[model samples]
Target: MLYLTINETNALLRTAHTDAFHLEVSDDHSAVADETEPMRRVLAGLPPFEPDAYPDSWREWDELVGEVTAHGVTMRRVRVVSEPLTDYVRFLQGLTDRNVRLGEDIRWLPRHLVDQADYTTDEWWLIDNARVAFTIFGTDGDFVGAALTEDPAIVDRCTGIRDALWRKATPHADYAPGG
Candidate 1:
């Protein structure tokens, strides 16, 4: 297992054109609550991030595709986006249109799903391709995301929990939201 802060992960995404990798994301609502707003921009063929240099996700997406096409590793992402439907559709469309498969779990529920004690308040994700997992807060700088590898048993346990959540997750379209 490896540890990476958000910046490290972003860097990996940027330069890792040769390695095939899958990115499984647990939608971090603690930071961005409006999925549609981002999707609206993306569907318009606009960049997903702000107008900053690194804010544009196209380069990262292109690099990720290079990994998949070159290394047989398809980038798979799972997100539970709060929605007004249109943004969810747009976001899903962008992800699905890429070399990535995007899906969602119960985290999109009107109420939060994970226990506060079980996971921190930050956004979390497990990169199955690298077998590395970690979490990042919305407001944290790119360097704030922590890589988990301190304890093998504990990391494996968390991985299992993530898998369980994945198994139980439904497609975003199938979700009832308030249900």
Candidate 2:
């Protein structure tokens, strides 16, 4: 039940020292949006829903992912979103190509369809199937902190959900935001 600042959470995740990193995101938009300057500029420059307008400035992120993958660290992310996606979700979908290129296995699951699956209501990361981190936010939807735990029961539950959602989710390349 340790409440951690966003920076602290990031540091913990970055230092995971694991062979696999898995993440489940339930938010329409993350509070700490991608801060890389090139990504920032491209997102700012695009029109509302430009499908083919991927900016070519994600080198930093891509390279970091390349290094991680090269070291045999498998990374995956699954997002649960509602129909009629929010602008932020749409924006995130637009960025999936970059994610895919960076060696992340990404998936999207429509929210209404998760009726009977093991689920987590909050956003979390299940690292190496051993640790679970729930990211917490403030009232105004600003980035606040995260709670990290190594309880086996908790980890097992989250891992179950991750596996179930992964089975149900749409691959990034085939998923459409409003479909």
- The parts of candidate 1 lying over 4 Å away from their true place are 1-7, 10-56, 81-122, 127-131, 138-145, 172-179
CA RMSD per model (angstroms): 6.8, 4.9
Among all windows of 10 consecutive residues in model 1, the one with the lowest summed lDDT is 102-111
Q: Taking the tens digit of each residue's C-alpha lDDT, what string does model 2 give over 1-179? A: 77778667655656555534455454444444333333344457654334564343344456666776766777788888877876566667777786888788888988888855567777887777888878787776655778989899998888888888888889998986665
lDDT of each: 0.45, 0.70
lDDT measured at residue 119 in model 1 versus the true structure, 0 to 100: 36
Model 1, 1-179: lDDT tens digits are 46676556665544433332222333333234434456667878886568564333556546545654455433433443334434444365455533333212222222255343333323444444333445544463222555644365654655555555555555445665442
Query: What's model 1's lDDT at 122?
Result: 31
